[model samples]
Target: MMWPSQNARRMWATVATFAAFLGGFLAYLNVEPVAVLFQGQHLQNLFRDVFPPRLAVLWERSGLWWSVVETLAMAFAGTTLGLAFALPAGLAGAANTTPHGGLRAAVRFQLSLERALSSFFILMVLLIAFGLGPFAATVTLALGTLGGFGKLFAESLERVEAAPAEALAALGASRSQQICFAVLPQAAPALITGSLYAFDINLRAAIALGIFGAGGLGAELLLAYNTLRYHDVLALALVSLVLVTAVERVSDFLRQRI
Candidate 1:
């Protein structure tokens, strides 16, 4: 292969130097300091910790199964609600579909306000409003969707087939009619895909929140961890891995189909 020119070599040199500096800084901070095999005492524990795995924990309470089901339900409900609110809000915010620039600005402002709210804070507020229950966790998931998906939905509406909208306007269609007949058709695939992606992510988030007293398998896992019930912890870990894999498979299938 031909050697790179001096400019290319300089660029590569800069990249290598930056990489080495970042690695050094990370090492200084001990981010995963024990990542090194055994790193000392961990190696000793490794020998002692290894034992027969318990697969029975999967059916121990039976609710592990139910919790998984409930978790999925929570994910669906929160996503649907978020999308429900996002649809009209997105249209109102869209520059073309909005009735006026001022109303559009207000929609944009509310969308911005939603984005500014933190997921963790929303979770806390839900906990206060509804108590430490799945309802609170579901609200947090919806808030997350509102921030991320709402913006994308608005942008999609703004960029959809303007020609069709103009044609509809020429036919003396109202703004709502233009949106229903012209805008939504062009934007459906992208908008639905975004919602699906957000739903999958919120599935994982719901699980974590559930673990943190949001009421689900997560709560059980947290309990197992706190009690030093390593077997239960391992079981829950495997269950979560399966759930995450299933979500990924479903997401990939939708992506291909959509």
Candidate 2:
């Protein structure tokens, strides 16, 4: 093993270079240790403030449960709308699906644009146009989902086996026919997986979207935080944690089945 010539030297050199790069980046960012984290009093004060989440407040606040329902609906609708647009856009962007290079490039560029715009910014603009509501949040989530899902779907389409497509071609099958018979079938599992994953992402995004006037648990949490209702904030956070965990389990099960 030691007779590997200069390989060991090269490996050591790479390690040294990586270490230097990391050191330089850390220095540039000026990362500092949290002195407060080491202080017992600070830790105690923080916990004392956040203790005992107010679950009863949820029932006290009329329509709070409905707000949760609205948030879930926003996520579902956004994912559905995003999938609707992503399927066609992804197909057009896929190298194997669309023969024309120019069209593929165009579709890819559009997807890139969609992905580049953050849901936060999109909600800000939509809030001006649509006013404050779940509508803005839904649309914001849809745009983000469109870009992310479209790229993933296109990659899945490109990754499908070429032999089936080739066989279809040999049989004088049309492009659309080949896609329907070969590519779609092969990519269906991936499509479902990606869509489910995107739904999870959209659900998280919907929460953040509430900060910019999109109504949801995020809006309620923000209000509680501003009004010094830490217990309500804690309760909301716990609910979100449970919901996310449930979605994770469901997604994992579905992925395994696929």
Candidate 3:
């Protein structure tokens, strides 16, 4: 029963406070926004170097298409491997399906630790053990997918309607039976949706990992940048944009159907 005027005043106060804080932070960082925006010489040099992407690089560059195929393969392999482990981990982590509270806590904590470690950092560590290649990049993507999808799948399983599970329990179904017949059936749609989302995320991560010498389109991009082939870099960036956009579109379509 607060007055609308009071709500408006509160909103305005919050906005003013945020603006003041942001302004203070920028000042502390010595950020001269207007000066940066008006850096005409630097901006002009950048534009001149990068304009007119080399469209022919899409086909002209030897092994460019092979790299694209390698990227797709990495994403697919990583997602499949991660989700294979994630399903069981999710079953163990979920509140309703977990065998015990201790097991659930352990599983969830492991997942959190995995998520806390960035994929790039993990990839760096893995490169030492596995050596730099698509294999290392693929493993990094798999671990990332496992961490993210496990948590999401656990939450999805936990959110499944309880009535069906309870009914199965009352009919003297075992814990495993209840989970398999009741909980999983209801949670299937959410799990499928999460899997698709995980694939989308891992595809982007694979590209980024390749930049660190993981060997794919990202490696190509890094090489172009290091060689000062700005035109080629721009063309590679366009290819990445198209690949991500296509996957996103397909993922959206699948999610809608689910």
Per model, how many backbone clashes are there?
1, 0, 0
Candidate 3 regions with alpha-carbon error over 4 angstroms: 1-12
Instruction: Look at candidate 1 and tell me the lDDT of residue 19.
Output: 85
Best by TM-score: 3
**Which is superior by TM-score, 2 or 3?**
3
lDDT for each residue of candidate 1 in 168-243, tens digit (9 for 90 to 100): 8999999889889999999999997898788788888877887667777777788878887766777787888888
Flag the better candidate by TM-score, 1 or 3: 3
TM-score of every model versus the real structure: 0.84, 0.86, 0.92
lDDT of each: 0.81, 0.86, 0.92
Any runs in candidate 2 off by more than 4 Å, and if so which?
Answer: 1-31, 255-258
Off by over 4 Å in 1: 1-12, 19-38, 43-53, 254-258
Instruction: Give the top-scoring candidate (lDDT).
Output: 3
Q: Report clash pairs, candidate 3.
A: none
lDDT of 1 at 224: 77
